[model samples]
Target chain A: MLFKGIAASHGIAIGPAFLLKVEELRHARRTLIDSSESEEEILRFRDAIISVKHDLENIADSMGDVVEGRQILEFLLLLLQDPTIKKEVENKIRCDKVNAEYAVSSTLLDVMDKFNIMKDPYIRERVADVKDVGRRIIEKLTGTEKDALNNLKQPVVLVARDLDPSETAGLKPGQVLAFVTDMGGKTSHTTILARALGIPAVVGLQKITVEIHPQDLIIVDGIHGCVIVNPTEKELSYYAEIREQFQEAESLLQQANPGPALTEDGVRYELAANIELPHEVEMVKSLAADGIGLFRTEFLRLIQEKGENEEDHFDIYNKMALDMLPKPVIIRTYDMGGDKFRTGLNSAREANPFLGYRAVRIGLDRPEEFSIQLRAILRASIHGNIKLMFPMVTHVEQLRSLLDLIKLVKNDLRVKAIPFDENMQVGIMVETPATVIALDLMLPYVDFVSIGTNDLTQYTLAVDRGNPKVAYLYDSFHPAVLRQIDTVVRLCHAQQKWVGVCGSMAANPLAVPLLIGFGVDELSVAPSLIPDVKKMIAVVTTHAAREMAEKSLSIETGLRVRALVHSYVIGKYPEILLDENDWKTGG
Target chain B: MIEKKITVPNKLGIHARPAALIVRAAVEFDCDVWVESPADKVNAKSIMGVMTLAASGGTLITVSAQGDQEETAVETVVEVIRSGFGEEMI
Candidate 1:
């Protein structure tokens, strides 16, 4: 029987299934106690936990983003604070019945058992979390440590049921060629880590242990999430050709890196990246982005406990604007509704967060906070080309209210003799169906409009992205979604306002041609995906894209639109086409 | 000890939170605190002085302190400006 899973991480390795069975854990625990003797064992156990704490801290320090690392450190700190575990060992010492090592082992078993019995998957996963903490502690105690990957003599493809952030962090790029896991979703830490490391990984292969034999010849395609076992020569040759084509295409994209994203007909389109943090400025520069298309400012508000002040907003925005200098940066003011802002501020628990008081609505409600941000933005504008964009504007009244606030803030600045850009360009993100319908009314008020397809598609289809059952219905290519996008783009263009798209759909190669045809002036995507999307855009003529968009819009079914776009893109640029077998095989 | 007044260059001003970040850095040394703006002058350690400065981002004010760490405190406040008051993304 053949089973396929989403290949999230990339690389191919054929190795015997070294299933990390629960029984090995049982053996290791049993051995831990059997080998220990006397009161000296408690000292050893304490030393072990201490060493693990140090190791965890070191790992956290080495990570690029301290957020996840800090989380793991906090977890370790909690484990050390576990009164039950501490008391058990102390009781053993006082009773003169068992050694410290035995006490520690028994306490660990109790904690692990509790974690395993948790009904919540997240809680149950904590069992591995405990084990990982245990392994680090034990390694420190026993002094029988394996060198950190640099000591590995032979390269191995790591196969795990699943890997946590801590475990994945310890993997060395040289020792691990690739990874395959039996479980993990696309946004799982395993997938993110794999992408960051540029390693190929396949995840969510349920019951892979049964099908994959140890030492089976397996070819893994990380991009398409395919794994081939004992492939025929024909299959190997086919993959080889595909691999060569991909490399050539990659090289071509690299050559185009220093060049502008212009079509064969010489129409240049602005290519920018959407960013969540100030740190991402480096990534945009590396991609040679025109500038930040959308800087989601809410991340700052989320990271801090209190509300963000104007100085904080100004400082960050000013720094980003100055850093990106010359390149125009469009900052979408805090789009903090939905899951993003629920934790703090006036954010209330809403049944439908996407449609609730968010973006400009919330900004308008709290003029003081909004003015602080606006003033900082205004102040930062003097440093570089910075534009302000409000998200989730549904009506002309909302736009007008926001514009009035901007004018008021500008006037206030002028009265204070504070220097600011008098004519800063302001824009709105047309994300809601209401906003799409009222584009003509809004067109005259704003400088430009960016179509946020992610939310737009979700709202159009009335499907929550978080709900797995209905997630498939949230299609960007849906006729309704496309029609809204097209209307907004066309209307904006007619009114001489520039329009762009900053959504997952914008980066999608299949949607690029259609977007171009829809008269999208810019495509803002993840920095890493920019080159590939640019390459796709370079091959297709504006004429072809328009034709494809026209065909796509007339289609009644979302799948048909997707299929048409896929075929249109592949027909024009076969090199950019993802391998079907690789996509299906769960490599 | 030489004392200099510097307004909170940060948009947030010397409020409780940015005040917390500032005071935490201040307590690392031994110094007497005072801050003054056009409107008022008050104890630097006094959260009130920082607040009264009403130093929103880009506001100009003065900072002064005394002790062996006086120069250090004054310089540190000035450094916040050079670094954009910890807002500068490196």
Candidate 2:
């Protein structure tokens, strides 16, 4: 039987289902302890308090390498030791003469009740942490080890109803093959943990835990969100072969060039890596990227000291530029919002964060933080390898203001006697339709343009990528999206400014040809995809790509466009298409 | 009594980190600190009360204090709110 769910972490795992049986919390009745026993009750509560405190501090102190564990644990520890909350719980035990477990659980319920009704997702999500602490404290007092995922006999597909934040911390690397959860969506802590663990996962199957039986044979296809349960031996062998072919092909890709991207036909394209965090630069270097394509420079603003100044920004940018060394690093001025982050004169809260004050919009409206960023980038550009870019360019005014801020920062640096590259190349992302149509108005201000196809497709199709129901409509290969790419590339070339395509479309083997045909000068892909994209560019001639791109415009539907591109790539290399059926249907 | 009304500006509002910071600062003052949102009033030092207020970004909330350090407590707490926990600036 096949079940569908959200494909979270990407991989394949075949294992016996190890159902994470979560035994319900079994606590004693809320009977009043005798007056003589009351002192013991308080003592028990005190001992548990110390135990829970030690537990949280241990987690915080030894945060080892959880990307965002220390700060969160610190916050949880503060919540655990709040004097006001301590007073409330103490009052319940002393005045009511109730058992410690009873008092603690009841007090947490009061907080949980309020959180359940909160409109803010961030506040509401904390309800889990509050309950985690409450449960931990109660377990210590009661000496109960209910539902602990402690030991496993062997590696198995760990399935659960709803994974708590605390439970996931105990997941040993090789003991659990993959994660399959019935609750929580794609961005839940469970999914994040799964991705971090580098395991196959499918979440929000709704009744996966109920349907999956222990020791049952299951194949988790993380790429397609398909879970095959108790498959026949024939079907099992088919998947095994596919997995082998995939790994073999991947190893072959690893042997591709570790140099600049030059097509076999001799056309040069900048194959850069998309880096969201600084740590990812190591992988970019390993993949041998020509440069950093879309450095999400906004993330540097987060998890930072409150009063970090221009020097702080300079430190990070300088390190990145030096690391890449002579390679152009296009640092986007924080395209924040829509699950990224909100900083710099813009609050995260908005009726419509996707469409509202975010990215360059906030920068133009209030230039305080924007000015600082410009100065930092300008100073770093003195290395002569850094290229600055702006996101969310829907208006000519936004681009003008952004350039104006760069002007102001340049003047400030000169006054401070700081030398920088006076002619640093500045660029804007042609993501929104307005920017694409108004290319003539905006190109004069920019030295290069990159297409952020992810957002462009979303806005053009009027589909929210977060809304799974309509997410299928948010295809980057939609004919209209292709037209937008074609227009941006064509317009940029006309003005003698370079254009690059970034995002998933740039890396997709099928979409790579279209982007090249659209006259994109660069393909900024994930570090892992850089080698594969470079190899594809090296093989495909730009002339044929342009011909295929022209024919794709006349295509009516997004499905046909995807098929067209798939067939074009597969016609040359049949192994590129896994199914081998996509090429046949394209005709 | 010292009182001031301020807007919560950080995007995530008074989530976890900001709530903890506010509580930490509140306990340092030798005064009774209270946060009054449009829906409910809560003790500023209590993480639950502060979080339960569910003040999203841009929500106007009032802070009041009464005691020896009332003037400083209210002033400090109000700044934290209006500042969006320093996320609005560098």
Largest lDDT belongs to which candidate? 2
Query: What tens digits encode model 1's per-residue C-alpha lDDT throughout A292-360?
Result: 998877666744456667778888988999899899899888776664555455545787776776777
Winning candidate number (TM-score): 2
> What value does DockQ give for candidate 2?
0.41
Provide the lowest-lDDT 10-residue window in model 2 chain A.
Answer: A578-587
TM-score, prediction 2: 0.62
- lDDT of candidate 1 at residue A512, scale 0 to 100: 84
Q: How accurate is candidate 2 locally (lDDT)?
A: 0.76
Q: Please tell me how candidate 1 rates in CAPRI terms.
A: incorrect
Every model's TM-score on chain B: 0.67, 0.91
Instruction: Give candidate 2 regions above 4 Å deviation.
Output: A1-3, A6-10, A13-220, A227-248, A342-348, A577-587, B1-90
lDDT (C-alpha) at residue B70 in model 1: 82
Go through the candidates in order and give each one's C-alpha lDDT. 0.66, 0.76
Task: Show where candidate 1 strays beyond 4 Å.
Answer: A1-222, A226-252, A302-307, A346-349, A577-587, B1-90
Cα error, residue B78 of model 2, in Å, equals 39
